[model samples]
Target: MKNLKESLKRRFSESNGGNEVRSPLRVLLRKEVAEHIRSWRFIILLTLIVLTFIASMYSSLSNIKSAFVATDNSSTSFFYLKLLTLTDDSIPAFHIFLSFLAPILGISLGFDAVNSENNNGSLIRLMAQPLYRDNLILAKFLAPLLIVAILFFSLTFLIVGYAMCISGIPIEWQEVVRILAFNGMTVLYVGFWLSIAVLLSIRFRQPATSALTAIGIWLFFTVFFQVVINIAIKAFIPDPNYLSADKIAYYNEVILNILRISPSQLYVDASTTLLMPMVRSLGPVSMEQMAGAIPSSISLRNSLMLVWPQLSGLIAFTLLLFAVSYALFMRREIRS
Candidate 1:
């Protein structure tokens, strides 16, 4: 084993015209990132997101104008955050735009990541190089993730800048931290879908098949899953309106917990908690728990504490899907 390892290091070093050996993951990552940046799918998604940003900014500006004129002065000091979350007559808020579009971007970047390369005979050739199997699969998973991060972060900063310019309000430090954290959480959410899509890519040799599979799952969760869950809940727990408040609350809790199993629901819960500081709780809040609770926005730390389980769930799902993809890829034969 040691002899083979030394031979590979020597061979790879000599082949790359360097005395020291280096991991091929970086080389693969750079190549994949460049490809992703140049892909039409990425371009289309970015363009759509930018258009949403512009529309959102326009409507947000109008909304913020009205908000500032209101006499209540009830908005927390972090009013600037509202510029991105609030919607007006015509356009959705920035976060709303993201909740819908982020999955499509993830599927686009990952649905064909592996199979397209296989179709073009690139995978075998790339694998033919002096690289370990782990390096190939890990980089394939990460490069798209990094690309998604770039797209998300760029859009986030652009929205923030536009909000600042239009609102004319300097965002507070705590607000900036929350926004930055929200960006990271959004990245993780999208990256989870990316990993799932890539797993489909690895499982299906046909790029179109993998792409369709990913889109089908997205549609199921986005549109039909809630309806299905409602039907199931209704069938199991009939006449909830006739029940007492405690019973009704328990039924709703059961339904909500079941719904949270879907990735989209989890993403929405976490995003809402992070972006909307006024959201006191995601789960059932009994009257006792709500007693004496002022109707006010909480600090960033408290908000994170509320949503940490959600963030962790997203992370776990992403890692689990990636692990499956890695295992499948490692077991696959290039020659076959």
Candidate 2:
């Protein structure tokens, strides 16, 4: 009897003493990222990105081949030359493709983030652990961001490899780095939507409602609001040329600032600035000898600076939305 009691006491003491305290942040991040990778949604998302990239490359390369083999025809050669040149600027082309697809992926990953956890009864159990409440929100936000980055870089590598093997064109270091940086910006731009979707997920307990809300917001930015803005601009500013150079510049700045309200638009404009050189008008000081003023294209540094306001806006909005979600999750009563 004494031995049994002593053994039981020793076991209890050892269990208490060996309660290894792992860093909640590290534990949550790893668990969340691993769970995301294991989910069918992540697999499907990655597969879609890979398959789409492959399809695009096949189609683009076929077009390039046809362009090179075209007969000595005026329209054929003209169009083919433009097409071939555009292919050389693949980074911009990739941006155009990602502009549409990235938001959908972002929304998909985040729309059900919180509600699904609640439905699965995981949220309550997760909270029961010695983890900070904020950890869950941070994990949810970061896992998708990491996935976005990984898929982007993977697609870039695949594209570069295919281009090299098929076209026999050497990859320039600058082109590779530029494309990589452009892809990174796109991931962050997509992260903004993910953050918004996560905020909605936390706000609504029903998964369907959260998903619908996210779609509605997506449509508003992509279609509805843009139409409204166009109409408003046309109606209010009937005479576009009445504005002077300084006024036009100021107006452009204002318009960009307003559009930054929607991350999608902000991203598109920032991308345009990044990918294309500015084609400035000659204006009154028009040099008769010169075709166009084309006031020196903005440097990459200037482009990055121009995007700063939008980037900062996105970061601020993401932080604010996340803060709200975290606060709500922490304060809510999770009844098991």
Candidate 3:
């Protein structure tokens, strides 16, 4: 391994000649991306996402005609956006399916990111090269992130094209913007999970341990967390029947604030607001607040404004995890 590293370093130095040396970061990033693309786990996850996309699109198309007819008399617009949010009862909409599957895709890509290299005894050898630890860790996160963005954008365009063919409606600029924004938010949401997985990978020595821990975290947020929240809410409220309106409102607010602590809830709120223009509020709206409001779809600006807090939260949490992972990975001793 030492000889191989020396030879590779020499080759790179010779190739660079007197010019600036090539960036090891770029080489590592490309290698990470290629490995992710060629991995069987990635292939399986990609196939699952594609299948779900197809199922959701099929369900959306089946209901889209009726949706159009039903909304014909209404002043609502952005029908093109419905291709993503609309679906039958049997299959969830694209965004809903994505929320569930995207996290798994992220976890699969990153749960073994660092630990697997360490287990295979390549990490110390890589560190022996010209690469900085910062570059290596950053490349690990960025490569999966880039691949995720590409996958999501491609799927979004595919949905758009399929919708256009079936609905015979050119997508409005507003609709295009909204769809793009949703895709971007989804990427961030997945990145949050990816960061968590990466952190676990760095923290645990075994890839299997990190992978299981990451999945356990996902399951906690996706399933058990909500249940615990509901139980806690019930324990607090006890009986809403006897509670005053003000008390009920207070508890409702508390519940929402608690739910927002979960990343999944944040993603859902942001995605829903972006994909559905009619969603004007993420929280409870008093009758007084809605009394004089016009019944109209909000503009793209308003939709973005509505989701900005959630989007910001997702960004903050993702960064926090990655930063923790980076700090830990950088400070740790690497031994062969």
Top model by TM-score, which number?
Answer: 3
> How does model 1 score by TM-score?
0.90
Write one digit per residue (lDDT tens) for candidate 3, span 246-311. Answer: 778778888998999999999999999998888899988777788989877888888888898999
Writing each residue's lDDT as its tens digit, candidate 1 over 53-123 gives 67876777688776565414675766756766777757667777888888887888889878988898877
Candidates 1 and 3: which is better by TM-score?
Answer: 3
lDDT of each: 0.80, 0.68, 0.85
Off by over 4 Å in 2: 1-22, 62-92, 239-257, 277-298
TM-score of each: 0.90, 0.76, 0.93
Lowest-lDDT window of 10 residues in candidate 2?
A: 75-84
* Stretches > 4 Å off in candidate 3: 1-22
Model 1, which residues run further than 4 Å from truth? 1-22, 69-72
Better of 2 and 3 by lDDT: 3
The number of clashing residue pairs in model 1 is 0
